[model samples]
Target chain A: MTSSTTESEFGESRESDSDNPSVTKVARSKLSIALAAVFCLSVIMGTGPGVLLVNRPESISGIPLVYAWGILWYFVQVAVVIVASLTVWRSTGVAESCRTHNAPSRPERNSAERGEGELPR
Target chain B: MTIPILVVLIYLGVLLLFGWLGYRRGERSEEDYYLAGRGQGWFISAMTIMATFFSSFALLGAPGMVYREGLVFALVSLNVPIAGVAIYLLGNPIRRAGKRGGYITQADMLCDHYGDGVGLRLLVALVGFLFAIPYVMMQLKAGGELAAVLFSGYDHAFEAGAIVLSVITALYIMIGGMRSVAWTDALQCALLVMGMALGGISLVVSMGGPSAFLHEVNQLPTSSLTVPGNTGFWQLPMLFTVCLLMPIGGIIQPAQWMRFYSARDADTLRRSALIFSVLLTGCFIFAIMPIGLGGQVMYPLELSADGVAPNERVGSFDQILVVMLDDLMPRLLGEVAGATLSSLVIVAIMAAAMSTADSNLHALSALFTRDIYSRFLRRGCSEREKLWSGQLLIFVATAFSLVLVLIGSRPESSLSGLMQMIVTLALFAVAFSIQLLPMTLDVLFIGRGTRNAAIISLSCGLLVAFCFTPLFPLLFAKESSPLILWINAAKELIPMHASAWGLVVNGLVFVAVSVIESRVLKARSV
Candidate 1:
């Protein structure tokens, strides 16, 4: 059962890679890693908008300069969406799917004996 | 009774219908009772994840925080991507471990490694329930207040709210169980997002457009948006801490872990985490910041006979959003919108609270039945009896929280203050189990440490967190000055902004004890 699954998975990967050119389902670069790092840093280095407020301390009439804090903040938000979309989009089955290929003999047999196993769901 | 009553009843009745449908599958086996028979798919997992993630804390607390703090409060949410990554990193392995062991709680993963029997699992689950009750009460508090506020000038509004919310939630939870919670969450989440957007728009429009509101608010001293005192005194360290650690605290949450257990595979968990990350990001960034900013712009002052600014309530920041609703929305539409928003906020909060609560309650019950009860009370009891014990525990836990709610009500304290105090109990409780952080890292990568060592480290970590709570106060009093205390106290007292130095202490002890255990094991082996 496990061997047959691997053969099919290999078959699927070959068929898909030939058909689709835009799918690279893994984070495999200094650039990608750097971008991921930068994204994470902005979140962790949550220095208040004070520094930004200092640079643009003057709000005209009633508008707080921080109102457009979105310009900075949303960029970070979109950056995350970009990275996430990239990661999931690329790795449809590339890095290695979770292991479900073993001949379920050991677990099924063991549980049958214990009366506690229900096929590991 | 009224159209509003009909809407609420239909809403709740539909929920019961869903729950009944789910219960139709049967719950005779442990598979059905605990993990939804482990048949949950990507969509259910995602919906459950979103619902639980976007709960009352986001709905009410986000806006309330904005009311108290400024637009800056929403900044804490920026951590989601990172938190998503952290959870993706942590939750995946934990999910894998759970799939391997049929372990349902966060402590299940921990206990399996630590060999501390159920002691560690019991500790984590018990803490989860303790922290959960108050957070649940906060939702109940919001739902009840919103009901009373909407039904203003009506008799028995408060009593009506309590009855309506509790009965509705209880019926759905009891009937539908976990599946009901997840499905209702999906429908409710969609409504919640739309309602928040509409309300935000209405507030902006009613405040005389962004132009006018901004113009008026710009006239106030800059200190208005900044904290009460100047010198960036209270907030500098606060933003960094709350924004950082709370997301980290989220990683250890057993309720959140339960969502992982329900997922079909690693791929589904990954996708769900990714989707929810976006949802959570949008939620935090939009939900409260706009409300906080709106409060500043819209509700300038109450009029006096002489037309001077009357003495405004100093700390009632949460009421700003409500006031804005009254000002921006017309009498009736405002009421409907408010009611809808209230429903979303209440369910979201309750969902978050309940998802976390039920998972924790189960974990606690497991400790009694699987760990403590079976160990002592009735050895080798039938699996069916053990399952019932878990259900009984859930009822007891719900009752305990109801008691906590009654107790929480009579106390003369600020809402934000109470939220901080209660959440602190949760953070402090779980902070100890963080020994698992390093342990988790090792297991996923290095494969180090014995079960005994893990337990000792976790216990010591718990101790240090408790010690710091009292120690910090004594330390503050002896400093012969109140500046640091005042600054720290500001965060500690407010629910969203509490000082997290205890978390730091907790982390350090957990690490130290784990290291101690690791080295001791190495030496003995040599």
Candidate 2:
């Protein structure tokens, strides 16, 4: 396998993305950090010790409190994922990267160019 | 009986058709066969990932757990979303690495990142082998259990059911590889979701709808409504740790890891994550959770000196769902209509089993062919030869797991203790798989871990986890041994899942080894 080119190229691309601090790059980083914060907080509240607050026989709108707590966290997690996908993931310039890295070597360049094969690396 | 059998036969035929289609569309390259050319769309990716993530664990095992433990499993259900978050967080990076490095299995990326070494590659493959076998065994066991419940009085029904499931799953994966597995998973995922929703609804309706159902649930014993449950097993610490770790372990397992590599793009995985989190979690909370709770209200456990056991009418806790469907459906919806829906749900349960079985079998084949056979046994094997070897491995692995499941199915067999609950097998598998977490994180993000650190930490973790498994004592010591007694005592005191224990030791060792290795390298440089 062409192991060296693959690892070095990927490593270099990742490093360069961090080194060149353009406005979009900085914003993307901030969004990613913020998104991570929300995700972590949600996990803590959703499944962690936060569950103790609702681990009871009491009902909310006729649903059991613990079950309701879980459902609430599920929605929070979904929102964080949706926000990350739309903002951070969408703006990662994955399409451009795919075109630069995969298009030249792959037989399916047309599809890559159309953003159908635009993966992270 | 005839209608349900007809439904199952039809379902099996559709699966074979999908397998043939995958073969016709596939290229002969190993990449195409193993990773589906790394070009799956969001829909197939989402469904396949969810289907493979779930398994008999979702349909039979989870409900069985809820029936056995109560509302504690409800909270454990939250682990689904954490797994969803992992798909994008861990998956995108892994996909990027796989695409860039032309990697196929978990061993590929890990070996490349840690500076490829034979020891590291073999250990990584060992993790995959250890994790996949028990998981595959559970799915096959689920098939036999389903048959035993459905076929009731038939001779050798359990054996026939398990063999059919193993043969069908192995044949498709052999014929079409990853493409067939993913395509069949898509169909199976759909069936599984429908089955969960319909099963929940049927149970609710049988108890006279939502308000009546909730009222009946509220009237049950307090043990059934709270944590530590009826059996007093899922205490707070155990629930929290298992909920936190198991999903991460599940996502990083061999099958799901390859699914990330198989995705068309980051966007496909992102969307897949969203769908998996929202849709599947919804199914769990609304659809699957009820089956177990409803089973309690419908069948009600018999509290004995041996602790809480399933009602006399219920064959076993895992059989609760099928038994409830058999008893309740015909009474509520009349014979023909009820039987049809029941058959569909039963096939859905089989789909859940097959979807997971095919993915794990397909992944195990890749691990063997790419990491072991081609790399060591045949240094310069042809692509055709590699593919053929992988197919052969799938058949052999399936048969091996089938034999284990058959043996364990016998009540007199010693292995029956390990096969008690589908959830127990799932946890046992994850204990090994979660051992991959620390090394995977270091390789993907931290980048400070040495090759030696990875190997040492992984070996330590696997050993620790193995010592905790039910099989460990069975193989090595009598239950009365001092070592076995101490281990059980520690487990009781800690109350965390076996995987959590493995991961704890794995993380600590990894950090210690990586720190010392780094310092030594720094001193050498100075």
Candidate 3:
């Protein structure tokens, strides 16, 4: 299953080398690792022990202290997601080309990748 | 009859116009109708996504909760940001898969990944329907409640309002489907934000300024300003459970899942996450929080003799913002201007409800058409037959929802009890939606689970979730099942939400079942 499926199977053509399945796989795996790390960090900061940091009885700038703390993290998350989307998710020339071309050749590629229209067993 | 009613009428007219426009642009193809040809830009996608996510719950329910519970409800608002993160982490990959697979619904990708087992497709469709109907009902109830208050003098106003809103919403979606839904949602999102900001600002100015508002809030009891909050319902354990699970559930629900499939590319969704996070946080803090805290000051909680504060509630907690808008806008702006602004706020409330309802209804239609009807009722139906079937289901769902809303609007209906029941059902829907998460993770990112594992794990997870719900108790003869005692014990021990508890079982069963199935398959191959 692992060999059969790779990030290249999902139309993420980074480095203009979508033709090279091996390179696309390596890039996608690295992107996956980076996303995983960010996700873990968000979980920690947004909900886990990070919640403890805001579970308090105070106020800042007239807002409840805890609410103020939560808002700060909210901004941090917004920054992080924007950074990730611009950088890690679309990090190559092929991605740039795909966007520019509006992915005109997507339907044929998608059908080939998905193997739809199969007879029901 | 009134200014607010007129404003709402005008708003409805604009929505119809958008529907007509969408109808003009729509093609006969399924993808064109369901996903707007998957060419949405960042702004439209962001606004539509945000609009669909907010619902009447954000506009009406959250502030009311804050009024009842205090700042802890504000903490719960942080869940919006977590959902934004989910959009980035979960949605981006899903979009990639969607693009690769030409997927239109949650079941489409899942059935493709696991091979089209009829049972798997049906289960996914059932979950989507169950999750969607309550949400549609919630928004319908909201519309009725808005009408009930805004046109208090008229008899049967609530039912009339609910029926009207339902018909109009269903009509628009029927006219142009997802295109009309998304385009109208973008406009509704803008109005929602502005309305919230206007309400907050109106209150602040009426009370002097932000500092004065804060000073008033500071004068309130210390309990209202801290964790554990008003009646102690926002205790850490419950808060932790809600903050963790509900956001993820909110994001991964069927409507949102389809939104992931509709994105033009990763950049559109990425930009959407950024916009959504900022807009929600701003509206939550600067707009929503003030109405709640201001309500506490305006209508202080009633106390008992012992002063234990048995419940964190006020007579009309849910109506605080609406009531405040009615009162403050008039005093602050005077006659014509005040009435106009109030009318706009009322329209905004309607927008909030309608945006959520349309998305849920649209997703439900797609789920029925693609997953169930095509699979069983008519396997080789033309695109026209499928489209018409999906369109018919919208009215079916809406009519059923309207009947429930009317029944709940009766004088004998316990408004508080009904609200509580609706809330519980809605939460239960989310719990069921979250069960799809493990399977989704497996299909999109991790390719480990087998077909049998997906089917069994989903069944077990949904069953466990149902058992943990409050509905489980009602199912018994005396409303006191054996499960009640165990649920009570579990709550006493951990104070966790049913969604959280269900998820523990869900993950464990999913991983365990997958391992067993995988081992069996390996042995068979050997």
Question: TM-score, chain A, per candidate?
Answer: 0.41, 0.60, 0.47
Clashing pairs in 3: none
How far off is each candidate at the interface, as Cα RMSD in Å? 6.1, 7.6, 5.6
State the displacement of the C-alpha of residue B473, model 2, in Å, after optimal TM-score superposition: 2.0
Candidate 1 CAPRI assessment class: incorrect
TM-score of the second chain in candidate 2: 0.99
| Best-first order by TM-score | 2, 3, 1
Instruction: Kindly list the per-residue Cα lDDT of model 1 for residues A71-106, writing each as its tens digit.
Output: 366467556656754654234333334235443322
Off by over 4 Å in 2: A1-31, A93-121
Clashing pairs in 2: none
Model 3: residues with Cα > 4 Å off, grouped in runs: A1-56, A60-62, A92-121, B305-315, B409-418, B421-426, B475-479
For each candidate, the alpha-carbon lDDT, in order, equals 0.53, 0.86, 0.77
lDDT of 2: 0.86
Query: Candidate 3 — number of clashing residue pairs?
Result: 0
| 2 versus 3: better TM-score goes to | 2
